[model samples]
Target: MTVIVGASAAGLACAEALRRKGYTGPLTLVGAESHLPYDRPPLSKQVLSGDWEPARARLRSAEALSALDATLVLGDPAVHLDVPERAVHTASGRILKADNIVLATGLRPLTLAGQPTLRTVDDALTLRKRLLGCTNAVVVGDGVLGAEIAATARRMGVAVTLAGPQSAPMALQLGPRVASELASLHAAQGVSLRLGAAVTEVSEDGVLLETGEVLPADVVVVAFGSAPATDWLQDSGLTLGNGIVCDSRLRAAEGIYACGDVARWHHETLGRMVRLENRTNATEQGIAVAANILGADEAFLPVPYFWTDQFSAKIHVHGFVSPDATVVEGSASEGRFVVRYHRDGAVTGVLGWNMPKQARQHRAEISLRCPAGVAASTPGAA
Candidate 1:
C-alpha cells in the first residue's frame, strides 16, 4: 500500500506519476482541504481577475483522478505519523497503514494580524470580492505574490499603493536595478509606490507605516511570504529546519519521502539544500520522489525554475542565485531582459522578464548542466 499525504499539486502529481510508472499498489491520498487538487498559480492571476472561474483551477478532473485508482480522503487532516507502525492517524481517528508514504504537504500563506493573505481558494475568493468592490488597495510586501495582487487590482481599475521594506519591488529577489525598473513599470500603470517602508499596523481602512503615516485604502492585501505546513510532523522524528530536511534523493527518513514546498532537498548542482515553493519544483520533485520510491536509483538534481505573470509582463527565473552574483547581461528598461548570475565565469542563475522562449531554453540548457563555460554563448545569454 502506498499512502500519500496532502492532496495538492505535489501529492496528486505523485499519485499520477506512480500510476504512469506502473505502480499497481493500493494508493490512498489524504487531504486536509475539501477541494480537489487545483492549480494555485492561476488563483492569484486569472481567478482573481475574474478571467478564469475558480472551478477551472482543478488540475485533474474528478473522473481523471478516479481513473488513477487512488482513494482520496478529503477534508481530513493528518494528526500523527506513527513511524514505527508505518501508519498515519487522521483527525477523524482513522489509522491508515501503508508500505510507503509521501509527504507532499505544501506551504501555508504567512499572514499579518488584521490583514488579508491569499493562499487557499476561500482566501482568493474573498480577496477577489473585496478587490472588485474597492476603488483603492494597499499591498504590503513587494514579492511575486504581492506584485501579482497589485497588478490584478490595478487592472480592475482600483488605485494601488505597493509598499515594501526594500528600496523597490522584488529587490530581495531581483536585486536593486531590476527592482527599480519594476517600480517604474508599476508607476507608469498609475500604481503608487511606497518603497523602503515598513507597515506598523493593518487597519480596516488602511495601513499605518513606521514613519507615522497612514494611507487610506479600501482594501489591504498582505503577501509577505509562506512557511511550510509541517506542524503536524513535529513528532514524526524527521529532520526539520525551514522545512522537512531531505537528502538529494528527496528521502526524509527510512521508507518516508517528502517533496514540493515542504521538502528542503539538497541540490547537487548548487551544493546546497533549497525549499522552492513553485509549481515546477513541486511537479518535478513529485516525479522524482515517485521514481525513488519505486526502486529507481535516480538522484533528483533539477535546476530550480519558476515564473510569475504580473499585468502584461511575464517573469521567469531559472537556477539559484546569490546576493553576490553578478548580472552579466540584459537590462530591465526594455521589459524583455535576461539577467545572468555568474560565479567564477560560470552561469549560476538566469532571470528573464517577458522572455518566455529564452527562459525555457535557458532552463533546458541549465538542467543538462551544459558545458561549464558554454552558458555565456546562448542566445539572450545575459
Candidate 2:
C-alpha cells in the first residue's frame, strides 16, 4: 500500500502518476479539506473577480478521481507520521499503514502580524465576499501573490494599495529593471504603489507605515510568502530546512518520498536545494516522485518555469539568476521581449514579457550553463 498525505495538487498528481506508471498498488490519500485537488492560480483572479465559479478551479474531475482507484480520507489531517512503523495517524483518530509514504502536505501561508491570507478555496471565497462591500484594500507584502491580489481587486473596482519593503514588487525574482516595468504596469491600472514602505502596524482602519502614514483600507490581505506545512512532522525524524529536505531523487527516507511545495529537494543542476511554490513545479515533482518510488533513477532535474498574469500582461521566467546579471536579449520596455540573465559569462535565466517563443529558444542554455565555468566550454549552446 502507498499512503499519500494531503490530497491537494501534489497528492492527487502523485497518485495519478503512480497508476499511469503501472503501479497497481493499494493507494490512499488523506486530506484536511473535504474538497478534491483544485487549481489555485485562479483563486486570485477569475474566482475573486466573479468571472468563474470555485468549482472551475478543480484540477481534475470527479470521474477522473474515481478512475484513479485510490481511497480518499477527507476532512482529516495527518497529525503523526511514524517512519519506522510505516504508519500515519490522522486527526480523526485513524491509523493508516502503508509500505511506502509520500508527504505532500504542501505549505501554509506565513501570517503577517495576524492579517488574513489566501491559500485555500474557503479563504478565497471569504476574501471575495469581504471585497464586495470594501471600497479600498491594503495588501501587505508585494510578492507574486500580493501583485495578483492587488491587480484582481483593482479590476474588481476596489481601490487597492500594494505596500512592501522592496523597491519594486517581484524585484527579487524578476530583477530590478524588469520589476520596474511591472510596477509601472500596475500603477497605470489604478493600483496604488507603496514600494519600499515598511509596514509598522495593521489595524481595523488600515496599515500604518513606519513613516507615520496610514493607508485607509477596508480590508487587509497579507501575501508575505509561506512556510512548509511540516509542523505535523515535528517529531517524525526527517530533516527539515525551509521544507522537508529531500535527496536528488525526491526521496525523504528509505521508503518515503515527498513532492510539491513541501519538499525542498536538491537540484543537481543548480547544485542546491530549492522549494518551488508554483503549479509547474508541483505537477512535475509529483510525476517525478512517482517514477522514483518505482525504482526509477529519475534525477528530478528541471529548468524552473513560472508565469504570472496581471492586467493585460503575462510574465514568464525560466531558470535561476543572480543579483548582478547582464541582459543579453531584448529590453523590458518593449511589449514583447526576452531578457537573458547572465552570471560569469554564462546564461543563468531567461525572462519573457509576452515573448514565449524567444524565451523557450534559450532553454538549452539554462541546462548547459548551470555550472559556473561550463559556458566557455559549450560555446555553441551558449
- For residues 1-382, what per-residue lDDT tens digits would candidate 2 score against the true structure? 9999979888888899999999998999999898888888899999888998999999888999899999989999999999998899999899999998999998899787767799998889999998888888998988889999999999989999999999998887787877888999999999999889789899876899988889998899999677889999999999988888899999999888999888888778767666777778888888998988888987987777788899988888887645655556666556777777777677777778887777888766874334532121011111
Look at candidate 1 and give me any clashing residue pairs. Answer: 329-382
- Cα lDDT tens digits for candidate 1, 63-106: 89889999999999998998877899999999999989999988
> Number of backbone collisions per candidate, in order?
1, 0
Clashes counted in candidate 2 amount to 0
User: Which ten residues in a row are the worst by lDDT in model 1?
Assistant: 373-382
Top candidate on lDDT is 2
Question: Runs in model 2 with CA error above 4 Å?
Answer: 324-333, 367-382
TM-score of each candidate?
Answer: 0.91, 0.94
Model 2, position 380, has a per-residue lDDT of 12
Measured by TM-score, how close is model 2 to the native structure? 0.94
